[model samples]
Target: MERGIIKIENGEIIIPDTPVWMTVGEMSDLFMVSAYGIRKALRQIFRSGIMDEHDAVRPFPYAEGCYAEAYNMEAVVAVTFRINAAACRRFRELMLRRFMEKSLDFYICIPAADCNHRTGYDAAQVWQERHKLS
Candidate 1:
């Protein structure tokens, strides 16, 4: 089996929104490591706050809202950033591959006409102004 993160392009991966949350199995497969190790690394990353916003990684109902687990895209990225040293080239490579696949293609379009304030500007433009994306 392909032990790697199921990217958005794969269509089988769970991505309810733009952040791209992945399950422990997906992360473990992506990193080619045990789920326990991913959890350990996540615990450390959570304390850092650079990735995890809260004390515990937010739980997401992935499997048809029947189950929930610590599923945060930012947390995964943060954990990868910390341990992606020379010793973990494979991890870095996987990250690169995932990113290189045009993950940003999944864009959220909010019609400007629907908003009362903005008439001509698209949601993406407003987002750029607020977050300085451009």
Candidate 2:
């Protein structure tokens, strides 16, 4: 199977508008690991019950007469966490950073009046100061 292209910019991974489903070979290329390594990680991921094989993987027609096993985004993330490689580390870090940013954004959007008074701290000010937002 041909490897799908993964784009990264300014240390952030860029996902395509359309959902991507990649075969083991494609994931190996994208993660800069051997196909065997990907399979190994997938085995562990499934064995640990982190993801269900039926939900995470599906067979897709890659050629006129052949079908290959392809993994969805959730499976891809699970595999990334299991793999030990520079690409995997970078992916994990970027995903965590994005999650934290989103959480902070949500918190900051809440008005100071809505913030919990029990903490005796203003959540909005704290977030703005920490993020260096004027």
Candidate 3:
């Protein structure tokens, strides 16, 4: 949280390092709501001007000459903030839980050698030798 604003180093909600894409139908299923309802809520969120249509909705190819409304995490987060639905709240909670889990995994998995290697050439030399990257 740099300067009191939430900044995700890698804002990939699903795979941690990969972009997350969610179709409107899928989100409706997750939220246990109708697809039209979800779409309406999203449109309201968009009208608030927190995010642009490009950032919120995208064309997702589902079949030949067919496209569906797909949303990214940014849009989902914004919608969750504006709505008071229980399902939306639950979705936000799950997202937060997953984000925290991924973040913890990232910190725990950083190699000690790699951490030391950033300090000096001597450490880098040692790290290289130990990892056989020389």
Instruction: For each candidate in turn, give its C-alpha RMSD to the true structure in angstroms.
Output: 10.1, 7.4, 12.2
Global lDDT of model 1: 0.59
Residue clash pairs of candidate 1: 3-29, 4-29, 4-30, 5-30
Q: lDDT winner among the candidates?
A: 2
Superposed model 1: Cα runs more than 4 Å off = 1-5, 8-18, 53-56, 62-65, 84-88, 91-134
**What tens-digit string does per-residue lDDT give for candidate 2 at 1-134?**
33343556677788776676788887897789999999999999989998899998888886799988989888888889888899989988898888778845333265767566788887777777788965
Local distance difference test, each candidate: 0.59, 0.81, 0.64
lDDT of candidate 3 over 1-134, digit per residue (tens): 00111223243334334455677677666556787877787888778777788866667767899987678878767766666678678667767887677844332233455544455555555655788852
TM-score-wise, the better of 1 and 3 is 3
**In candidate 3, which residue ranges exceed 4 Å CA deviation?**
1-17, 97-134
Candidate 3, number of clashes: 0
Sort by TM-score, best first: 2, 3, 1
Give the Cα-based TM-score of candidate 3 against the true structure. 0.55
Candidate scoring better on lDDT of 1 and 2: 2
Instruction: Report how far off residue 103 is in candidate 2 (Å).
Output: 4.5
Candidate 3, pairs of clashing residues: none
lDDT of 1 by residue, 32-63 (tens): 66778777777777666655456334466545
